[model samples]
Target: MLNFLKKNIALAWAKRHVSQTENFKNNAEKLQEELLLSLVKTAEKTLFGRSHQFEDIKTIKEFQDKVKINDYEDLKPYIEKVKRGQRSILWPETPEYFAKTSGTTSGSKYIPISKEGMPFQVKGAQSALFHYIAKKNNADFVNGKMIFLQGSPELEEVFGIKTGRLSGIVAHHIPNYLQKNRLPSWETNLIEDWETKVDKIVEETEHENMTLISGIPPWLVMYFEKLTEKHSKKIKQLFPNLQLIVTGGVNYEPYKDKMEFLLGGKVDIVQTFPASEGFFAFQDDYTKDGLLLLTNHGIFYEFIPLEQYGKPDTERLTLKDVELNKDYALILTTNSGLWAYSIGDVVRFTDKNPHRILVSGRTKHFTSAFGEHVIAFEVEEALKSTVLKYPAKITEFHLAPRVNAESELPYHEWFIEFEEEPANLNLFKEELDFQLRNRNSYYDDLISGNILQQLKISKLRKNAFNEYAKSQGKLGGQNKIPRLANDRKLADLLEIYKL
Candidate 1:
């Protein structure tokens, strides 16, 4: 019965709302007004009148002017208010769930997600599913059991509510009705604690014919590797009808080839850009280049020119005014009671009306050593091309800058775990170095002496990084193996790169 509902409800919504969905492409002004109205209404009730994060800004423009541009740093005050159990700033009463996100340190962010926000997540996730079904015209496979690799609670209290991170909060919303109807008999609790659920999730997902899978790229990669090691043939044997594999949370380019290898064949893949703040976008179809924003749902959109958003000067733009194909940083006013919130991801629209955008990278993940700026996506592309040249099976890797004191050039060090041992590791480095330079000429020029000198490869024991993450209490559901690090600080725990 639930499978019947899962298959039919989404299609019914799409059919009845075909014209509305079409409005996504035809009318940008109408879409923006609807979103703005939702934002202002939610804001008036939650902020201005209630929440303290926003005060004294009676009009939308005034609120936009006074709030300033925000990153996570800007959210601290609001989070603290929530921590103090003050309902005066955002919403009334304690939010039911908090989504946790980890940064470089143990300073995990606890973003409050209300019950109101849950519907957006549910529907946002559904968009990826429905889009796939609509494109493939395959409702049979859509009715199958799905697996979501998710984080467990690290601590019981976050933002003054008994909460964890967004992944766990999302886990809580997996409707009981769906669980009863769709989950296989083979599921297990991967999250033993908040810090140690990644490994346990890998252990649990093996051999299951995962019809649908969603999680961060890092965690999915680790899970795929483990699944391939023990149950590679079994994966195809058991899940012959497997239809879709969805992943997000980080850039997907680095692992795309390897993910295809792990699944034993090509499978429909959908990428999503979702933060603890709100549902941003989902891949429009299996073949589209960008994600379609959930324009009429969840949150209202605002874009500050990427340059202007962080700058002290320029004003932000509303959905109606954003330029096409230009980079912009997003500020959101959400139904979850977060107002004029800066979620800190950078996005660019590929299409104007239907509102398709590519998530370029995070604001923090850029590399600027020697002023040879390389974004995470660039680094990911370089690594993918580099890895493709070698016969070695790259189990895992972390890329970081190693500054040479004598020459002043910053070389790249790749700490990799390989299945096949290579005779001369320097060969791997030379090829990788060549590719990096070709991809980014600045990377090439810097390599002679004043730039990067060489690329270094370090081999790790199988699952060594996974074991290390387990030690740090990060093993289990949805924790990804750290693929790249900007600095050498975390390198000491990882295996050293060989010349």
Candidate 2:
């Protein structure tokens, strides 16, 4: 009776959120325009706002003209001030928590999550599940145990501000009502070692009625693998009621086949576009390929064409200005006091009416060693196509250029961990090469001119990616292995470059 009531309550709320979703969909441009002004007005008294003359900015154009698009480095000084207990430095009030995240070159980064902005983050996540429930007209999963593989929940205080991994911080926000149905236990979740944590989680959840699982794809994959290996049975045999999957941080296409195989059946996947900075999008329809961008959230967004990015006169585009199928660098100004911040993600619009999008790749994460400029989307799509014919399940894969004279011609090298190897290895390589060339014209040109050889595959041993990640202290909880690298740093570290 309690489960029935909970499910009904969820459905009712989902119904109401539909209208709210519709309003934002139809009036995205208007909503965004209002939000930009509102954010400007709200933060005008803050140090950053005052410095940028936000009070005088009445229009989006005026705001853009007054404030330049900034990366983390540009805002580091202000972020430092906030870290030292300065109030009204970036936002008007002190942050409720600082989401600490790993950076490639900057090392540890502490991103502020304001008290005012935190609820919207929680809302975006709720709406994702709510939207799924409303569309499917089924909330069976609501009553069952749900697990979110994440960073250790134990937090450390830094100068009066609680600081921890973004996932760890979010873990603390799970509602009291749902606490009974969430796992693993608090004591187990506090284990800092991901390997031990995952093993403990496997023991705890192996026999539970788990209906929903949430985490980044790679970590979730590890959990599934461990569970199946321990019981010597597929996931469906263990958790027959499992219905939905929630994931973010990386593209899912490359892992779809492997994930589904591990599940032992097809399941609805909810892909969310979330970052330490903010929640941007979530999959609203199971049938659709793209995530619906949230316009009504406390964020005002801007986009710069991928080709025009980093230029002196590059134009910043709003929701109304974006075109379908064009790759753009996503920029955000949020209620949490991020002003015209470039989060380094590249996205492509799949639909224009309601602004549905796909995360194309990262602006800084691509391989252009031979001027091919191969992006993650292209590589993932190519691999997807090739795998259809080759019939291989990939655990993980990475691409880097091989340019040494000792090895022969310059070429792209793929280090792949496969659960199921292809029947014909040479034919598999040929198919992959063909698929990539079909997607990237520059790569095709290079191959045709004999400037580069066809991409080579170095089949990696099982748990190769996990070992590499563990070595870097990023074995779990939202850490994604970069799909494309311009240099051989990753390849050299993993020792996969030696042919």
Q: Whole-model Cα lDDT per candidate? A: 0.65, 0.89
Model 1, residue 61: C-alpha shift (Å): 4.9
List RMSD in Å for every model shown: 4.1, 1.5
Residue 415's C-alpha lDDT in candidate 2?
92
| Local distance difference test, candidate 1 | 0.65
* lDDT, candidate 2, at 220: 86
Please write out the lDDT profile of model 2 over residues 195-313, one tens digit for every residue.
89999999999999999999888888889999998999999889999999999888888888878888998678999998988989999877888999998888899999998899987
Clashes (N, CA, C under 3 Å) per candidate: 24, 0
Question: Which residue runs does candidate 2 get wrong by more than 4 Å?
Answer: 496-499
Give lDDT tens digits, candidate 1, residues 1-499: 8768767766665555444567665666576656555555555555333443344544557666555555555666766777777774565445667776776532777677776776887778766666766666566555666767665534486545767666666666666645743432323443355323444555555544457766676666766655666655634555676777778877677666667666776577889887778888888755667888877676767887765655676768876677776667777877766666677577778876678888765555555566665555556656667666765556567777777546455577677777555556677678777877776666777776554667766677776776777677767554555455566766777753332
Best lDDT goes to which candidate?
Answer: 2
